[model samples]
Target chain A: MMLKYPNGKPYKPKNQTPEQVGTGKVKDFSFGNRGKTLEEEINETNEYYLSRQIAIVHKKPVPIQIVKVEYPKRSAAVIREAYFRTPSTTDYNGVWNGYYIDFEAKETESKTSFPLKNVHEHQITHMKNVVDQQGIAFTIVRFSKLDRYFFLPFSVLYESWCHMKKGGRKSIPLETFESKSYEIIPGYNPRIDYISIIKKFICNKEC
Target chain B: MMLKYPNGKPYKPKNQTPEQVGTGKVKDFSFGNRGKTLEEEINETNEYYLSRQIAIVHKKPVPIQIVKVEYPKRSAAVIREAYFRTPSTTDYNGVWNGYYIDFEAKETESKTSFPLKNVHEHQITHMKNVVDQQGIAFTIVRFSKLDRYFFLPFSVLYESWCHMKKGGRKSIPLETFESKSYEIIPGYNPRIDYISIIKKFICNKEC
Candidate 1:
């Protein structure tokens, strides 16, 4: 059954994974298929980091607008009606060391490029605002097909988004990202040790 | 209509007010009845701090689970079915000068004491976890009727909550707060300047 919005517009899920797409040239890292998705793995890694008192970061819970609820008991309340709220910013934000860190994580099957549509306008604006306030803003883009991850700065994402708006292209070329972005090699313990890269490259010098 | 939880137990909306009823000791502070709430005022204060590069703090958005939505072609999306999700932590958290700060803002009408029930179990647990991890955790209690504010540290809150569980009392006495807590005098620019107090007490020694 096709999902349609109240106004008859086709409903599109915000973050959908490209399932059937095969892996590309990028290296694939496994955190074990313990029924945990990439997002969940990243969340666990964040928890690990928090537990170690190494950094303070958290995934912002999905925003929902609740309308109706059914109270069956004192402890468990079941929601009867709800709708998703479009977030104004990325999925994750916190302070690491002395810098404010804001970022979103996305995985894609496309080998050649990363889609611009994956990054929402509101998220871009939010990142711009953070950068304007001198906060560190970036995205953790995972080319799942290639099993590769890159931390792309907000500045680069902003420029690419503008280009896309001007009818240039819908995706950022892989070559462009390779040169400008910091590549995050996955590890066994942390799964995605992107912050280590950040500490080595960004925070060490800037802070 | 009385609200009942899923377990068939009647759910009581927490009556959060000062413990000493009608003492008229706690002062009153207003954000002006201009449609903006205490949360918005705090958000504005955070923005001010961000602008000045003094501190980084934010109010986590209320979590909701959305089951349905409607998208009108020319208007904003309307949530059709939604329910409120229990938050696992305090309302606000961030870092300043390398010290992790986490807090919850609550308003009450009574004058003598703050109700222990004003806070949730999960929030208390989260605060305890933060404290265990060596992060600063506290609550910003605003006596709306009296227009007074106090920053009650997690250590004190945890102690009071434990006592309440042991059938000691349902609230924390105002006298106890007045003696142990830091009184935050409201101002025009930054509505609640708790960070300044933190700078004086916590950050100066640590950072």
Candidate 2:
């Protein structure tokens, strides 16, 4: 229910941002991502990255096990019956400037803290696998009430997720997020400039 | 219409092997893969690789756009209406041994050659992007009638794809497959070990 779209297709809000917001933008999250969810915004950012030949990130298509389909006269095949299969990895992953970039995007309405339940066991395990292979892995968290987004690194997430599994706090405090993660500056074309943070991460690691 | 699975969900057969076939083992194209299509074998090989902590390759879930979904109480979400969408990238991709592995899996019944129409234009373009990013990319071409399979590198595929646009032959002949590609030695456990060919490819590139 979280990522659901009323039009049955979640897509970029064409011509809404630059024209509506005008040279600048709204002061809060409501005006920041008008008429779209955080996922849609990040997808747009990825598309922007793709068009400029900067990065090759993509949200993996939703997993479905098709039971029946009907083909009608040289047209697209219509799926009759299918069931959603649990996805194994994070929603976004791709090759970026010789490094493997992987991450899950999630948004919460809570103003104080982000719950650990926002992530899943399999996803955390997948992130661990990516980290072990020396690939960059992380999460993009959006706090809607606060109008803020953070590029939470996998190392920080794994520590919290691991702590939760061991009967610790059920949520990562907002203060922790503000201090720990890199702030993702929202912009016009690439709504969430998470890769900019990645460049810095790569830079510090190299140094 | 492409990638359709018979029996609704196409999967590997359970426990039929060389022993089941008379004369020690069935020879030629007939026994190259038993009870499963070439795609399934590669998936198994990927599973083997993942299980051994060697790689993390996966067949991207088939692209489906959900139009309607019903949530029955206490059970998995059932999708009532959906349609297939054209995939932009190849079917398979993952990080393997610190390299991004991406490719399409296609099978042809023709014994002489593989047709170019089996691959879409966007897929070829996607392969070019991956190639440009210094990632390992290729196609797993299966000759079903002859029970033969080959690893066709992206360079060869791109060159042929380019030639086709210039009014050249629309298919790659069997002779070209014999010389330009790596013949996969089909095995029992992993079924088709394409990773072995990838190892050689890596060695040659580094050397």
TM-score of each: 0.69, 0.84
Question: Which numbered prediction scores highest in lDDT against the true structure?
Answer: 2
TM-score of chain B of each: 0.78, 0.83
Cα lDDT of all candidates, in order?
0.70, 0.77
Q: Could you give me the TM-score of model 2 versus the true structure?
A: 0.84
Scored by Cα lDDT, where does model 2 land? 0.77
Docking class of 1: incorrect
Best by TM-score: 2
The candidate scoring highest on DockQ is 2
Q: How much is the lDDT of residue A207 in candidate 1? A: 78
Write one digit per residue (lDDT tens) for candidate 1, span A18-126: 3211111222344373434567668767878877766667777665444455656543355554444555567887656656677898877799999887878878867
lDDT at A122 for candidate 1? Answer: 76
Listed in order, the DockQ scores are: 0.18, 0.32
